[model samples]
Target: MADNLNADLSCPICIDFFTEPVSLECGHSFCRDCILNASRAQGEPTGSIACPQCRQNTARLAIRSNRLLANIVEGFQRLWQPQPAGSGATPAQCQLHQQELRLFCSEDLQLICRLCWSSDAHSQHSCTAIKSAYTACKANSIQLLQKKLNEYRDTHTATGLKISETLEHTNRLQEQMAAEFAELQHFLQQRERALVQRLRAVAESAVNQLVENMALISERCVLIEQALEEIQSTQEQTQFLREIKGILQRCDLQTKPALKTPELHLGEFNGPLQYTVWKQMLNIISPAPVPLTLDSESASLDLVLSKDQTMVKGRSKLKEFSHHAKRFSNYGCVLAREGFTTGKHYWEVNVESIDEWIIGAVKESIDRHSAFALTPSNGLWTLRKWNGNIYGPHHATESECCQNMNLQKVGVCVDYEGGQVSFYNADDMTHLYTSTDRFTEKIYPFFLPFPETMTKGVLKLFHLQL
Candidate 1:
């Protein structure tokens, strides 16, 4: 029992048996402070009192007291001290309640004496064998803390990766935007240069047009000044002519009394005065020349009329017609026909009788001249000279003259007064189309000659085909 008591008694610093006690780096020791202090003071700093066990230099700072270790040491010392006899086994007591405890399990987190288990505070709490609940609660708490720490570390790692990816994507997009902006700026500069060039060209053209117009005006002014000078010289010559006429009259009266009254010879008044006056008047009255400044580069030819033969009319007498080239003979005989001409033909006539002239292409010569008063009817008036054309003929089955005749027959009839031209299938007198615009001015018509007959004479005697 004495040996057991000695084994439990421990040093305050090392918390073990006090067998070779040595001081620590903190200067607290059992039996080695003298040798350690002596060794430390001999070398390095004179006041260096480093402990031999912990190797701490105790010269700079004071040693701190180990309260927990001191308390445990004091408790162990009290337990080793002598006690009175007949002390019955003192029950373990709870520090909080000051009551004797019958059970305690350090491993199970439970401290329940019989009295505590019966109390309301500990009735629902888990209670195990002595010292078991405390160990279990500590182990469970450590596991829970470790799980939470691992989860926080994983979350932080994932967030860091996402931030890095987003930063990389932002950097790429910024670079792309900068490159696109540079290309756009280059394109805009090129367009600006082209526009400036075009504007300069337009300005130069405008200046050139202005210069041309001014030059034309200057030439016109010079012509006007020349005209004015001519007119002034003509006026001076007219004044001289008047003075000479007065002198001639005085000589005639004075010489009449002298003899066989010499006749006053009035020489012809031909002079530059008359010519200058005439030229100046002509310059003032003549029409200015028209500028044919058409920009032919842009002209189009979509609606131009095709060139055909010209036609002219005779005035009155048949003898007067002989002066023109003998083109064709108008055989004085009129036909009651209406159709388009296939080949080119020309003829003219003077109306000797006042008859209703149904000149345009029609199905038949109807006696209904009253219905022809309308503008676009069967019987159209010839208000002015006109030219017409007939397309190729195909079939004709209507009129009697074209019932079974050759189908390749067409005719074109022109009228001057009515402003009308018509096309027809001459075999059946079937009118096809008509036009209203006329050619009133004189024009020579074209004619295709037949090889069968060449007889030609005045209007009294001429050749006929049908």
Candidate 2:
């Protein structure tokens, strides 16, 4: 009993009972003084402190005391303490047997009186002194708990991001459907009106043709009536006979003209159904790009800004523009005149004369003179090409150094709030690279095409919308 109690209450470092236990981020617990000494033994290069047990890094300066653990240790100590013989009433005794409950079953996690240990339920179970089981359980449980907590935190964050993106996608889909449906309805109405007008014209043409025939018949009837009056009033057989002969000759083999109906062809309602419209709508409905122009102030000295600032070239020998702090000094990088703080924007770049370039979204405050690698860690999310190699921002080996690396034009797509930028070949829209961001400020479309002296390179900004 005494040995089990000693082991349960012992601190791993001191090999004695715990004296103010503290928890480390790695799920390992130790005496408060012991863990602190271990942390100070080694320093983190990145300024984040690392746990001595698992080596997990964190920025916390000091760890909090495990108060609940301390209380449990105290309770176990009291439970194991020996009472003066006959001075206290008694130690814990099992209710059924009135015998002391001594053995602990690790699997059942319960104390068993001596009589119960020999019973059918406990005979095959592994049992040890209660104190030994308690100590072992606490040792493994604390570490397990810390691991679970860390896992939960990461899972929660990832789940939250997924939910947000999914909801946004749903909303965007709804808006697209609404717009397409409205357009389809408007189109159907115009076609229906046109068909109805054509049907009325057919009826009108048929009625007009019949009316003209009737007018001609009425004129002949008037002539016949005049001839009959002349026959009755003249009272001369020879005059009547002459008129009748002329009428008979004119009427021979002649018939009324047939009424001609207008051959009106009404437009048909072609349908594969809504799906067909939706599919066709994608090709017909082109959304306009958000209008933006370049900011010459942010242009690098080696670059020349066009009069409208929408185009820039490396070859122009324009007079040097006034200097500004925002201008890039070291790298041949230039920022767009306008910066995007939020929303989705897409634009295309004409890389006609450029053989080497680095283009993507640049942080608003990128270091101009730092020789540091232009990586995402340094606030640059770029897809770069040097000599003949095309490189992505993610991995060192994620590059193609082939001789026939065809890169004529490039497309830049930015999702500001989503913290992503994707680049593609403008001609075929073959995906080139995509980067995740850690953006905290407004970002602009950054350009770093080779200067005009380098292969007559020219980087022109043009808006290509979806």
Candidate 3:
């Protein structure tokens, strides 16, 4: 049973039964010291030992001390200390060094003899003094592990701080952005309210103006109807008088009756009743004559209209004029003098030409007052002349003439010597109302259709009907 148990026992290095154990490439093995010692004696390094049986090397310098084996050997040596008188006891020897091992050192836990220590192989090597090297190596390894742990902890702390700071900054920026958005919304709302209020005010003013214009136009229509009625009545009276006159002419007063004769004489009605009535009607509707003397003294001529068809002259010149001035074929016509013996004279000019023409009312007539005598090269279009009156549609009445009135009916007039052409309001002048429309070129001439009743020397009157 003991032999069976021993069979299972193993050498620590080979982890197998100790039989011819050999050293390894690292010079560490079991039962290879004797071969290693012999190799060393042949000039091999002390640590380099080999096994003859297995041809393996070992570190001879490493002390191999087996505690259990030493205990068993000691027990056996004690039992055999006293022997029989004639019996001989064999001494144990180290197979590696071929020497006896006498001492067992507890400090190194190695078995050694005095001869081995004194031998050249181990003579210079220090004897086993203490076992503190193992404890020191273990302590140094623990310190290195602690340093690595500290480095990892510091790195983790720094990374965490950066993450916190980034989050805080992001939150602050988001709050600022939100505040800006709120302010922008408030500003837009305020502007919107202001704009709405301004638009309302403008709309109200426009509506009031429109209402006033309607009232004025309605009054004008009533006066025109009354004038027509008066004309019809005058025509009827003149026809009656003509019939009575014919009857008187046919009756013979020479043949006399003998008893109770009555003397009858037909008196001729000399006055042209119809013509007189028509003339009176015309005067009522006609624009009031602006006196030449007054016109000359005043800075400008002001023309105002009443519901009774009376023209009132105010202190200001016609605030507006017709827009078709550029279309007049006779440029001189625009400067014609009003209230001339010829009749009521008027002309038109383009809106663009007004600034170049005589601005304000004529204070004094220039020597070359005739519109025809004025030439385009002389810049006479920019000066006032005596031939005609310039009028705008808006200036037909006071209420209609607004500073913001559409420029469509504004024009200047020039009247020269004989022939005259007057341009009235027309649709082609629509461009003046908007800034986007550009006037790139000079305006051409436009002629007014003359009425047959208007004699060559007589001035013609033109009015805006619509």
Candidate 4:
């Protein structure tokens, strides 16, 4: 009621309690300054102006002061103002009995007057002095607040410890990164020296061959010059003829093919230099992709495995196989043959055109015969695509998993010690989701072709060339 009354008293233009309130002939009210501004905004004469609310022309001087509304607004303001300190608060009273409520009714959880406490309405109910009830209520509130305060303080201390632990871990990672980069730099330096030396050795051999050819030509030229001089200066025709024959033979020997210039090839050092080096660097890098193959013994009867065990597809008809306790009897799920208890491992699965599939890691010891929920608490950390929608752990949707890109092939990476399992779009290496958990035992890669009869696409393990 107060809010409505306040809204009624407020000026339409100023949106506040009217200051020097005035009313136009159109029945709309506004502050004196607000109406004056509106009149000027209309760019009309002061004697005549349009009413801002109704857009009807009216004489500015005809506006009347609203004394009643001004008084009501002032009274409403004072009514809600807080009373001065030491002013006693009003005590509760029984509406029916019209008496001070000094008794408490335990059964009704209400305050009652003395007369009502004795009446049949509350005769069987336990009653206590309101003063005693107030004391007990205050004590309980204090106790509850203390308990919450202790809990919050303990949480604060634990958070501080976590912060310290994270900082220490970050420092260790920095040291490791620096050491690894130093090793790469050393390798690059040695490779550079070896390549440069090889090039220099080829250049020297080519230059030496060219120098030998030049020396032989110089000797032949000297012989030819001597032969020319003997032919021109000789008085005996027989001697000149003999020397000419020897000179011609010398020229023929010099004309014989000299060693071809040694071909110098840069091989991979010419262009796309960085890419070539990076490809070679893969040979030295650790934690390469794991070679994961589906375990045929662990596959469900409704699923079929390829000869290489790298692909799995739903079976049109159930296949007869030796009963294995490790096989998933309920769900069309298959565990990888290799399991990891420690260290980081990465692998990719071709999920292209596959509508429904579940790919991730599962605990080695999880129940194989029963259908289990895809969640960390159930010993499964997985990303699933079902009914055209992708889901992460706990059935969270694709948006919740922060999947902002298309997925073709799916990449799964697990860091056992770091307690993290991450999924990605293998085509572009875009991260899709990550789940963290403290793993206690061996975990194996798992795949599900899903919907026994509906899905037709096969899930193939992608082999990494690096």
Task: State the lDDT of candidate 3 residue by residue for 1-466, as single tens digits.
Answer: 5344332333332222333444455534443443444465567666665553465556655535455554543454355444666767655666666755543343344545544644565544443211233355457568878988899889889889989988987898799668766765565565456646656665566666666666765665565565455444655776756664444333323432232222221121224644544444444332322221111221122222223321112222345544332222332222223323233233333232121122211212332222443322222222221123332222233312223332333332222222222233333433121101112222222212121222222222234321
Off by over 4 Å in 4: 1-130, 177-186, 229-239, 250-254, 271-276, 397-399, 403-405, 451-455
Could you estimate the TM-score for every candidate? 0.25, 0.46, 0.23, 0.68
Candidate 3, superposed: residue stretches over 4 Å from native:
1-164, 184-192, 228-235, 238-466
Instruction: Note the Cα lDDT for every prediction shown.
Output: 0.40, 0.70, 0.38, 0.80
- Per-residue error for 366 in candidate 2, Å, reads 3.4
The C-alpha stretches of model 2 lying farther than 4 A from their native spots are 1-287, 290-292, 315-319, 368-372, 399-404, 438-440, 463-466
What does candidate 4's lDDT look like per residue over 96-116, in tens digits? 979668667767878887557
Considering every candidate listed, which one attains the maximal lDDT? Answer: 4
| Positional deviation of residue 116's Cα in model 2 after best superposition, in angstroms | 49
- State the lDDT of candidate 1 residue by residue for 61-86, as single tens digits: 34444455555546664676445578
- Point out the higher-scoring one by TM-score: 1 or 3: 1
Best candidate per TM-score, number? 4
RMSD in angstroms between candidate 3 and the native structure over all alpha carbons: 38.8
Of 1 and 4, which scores higher on TM-score? 4
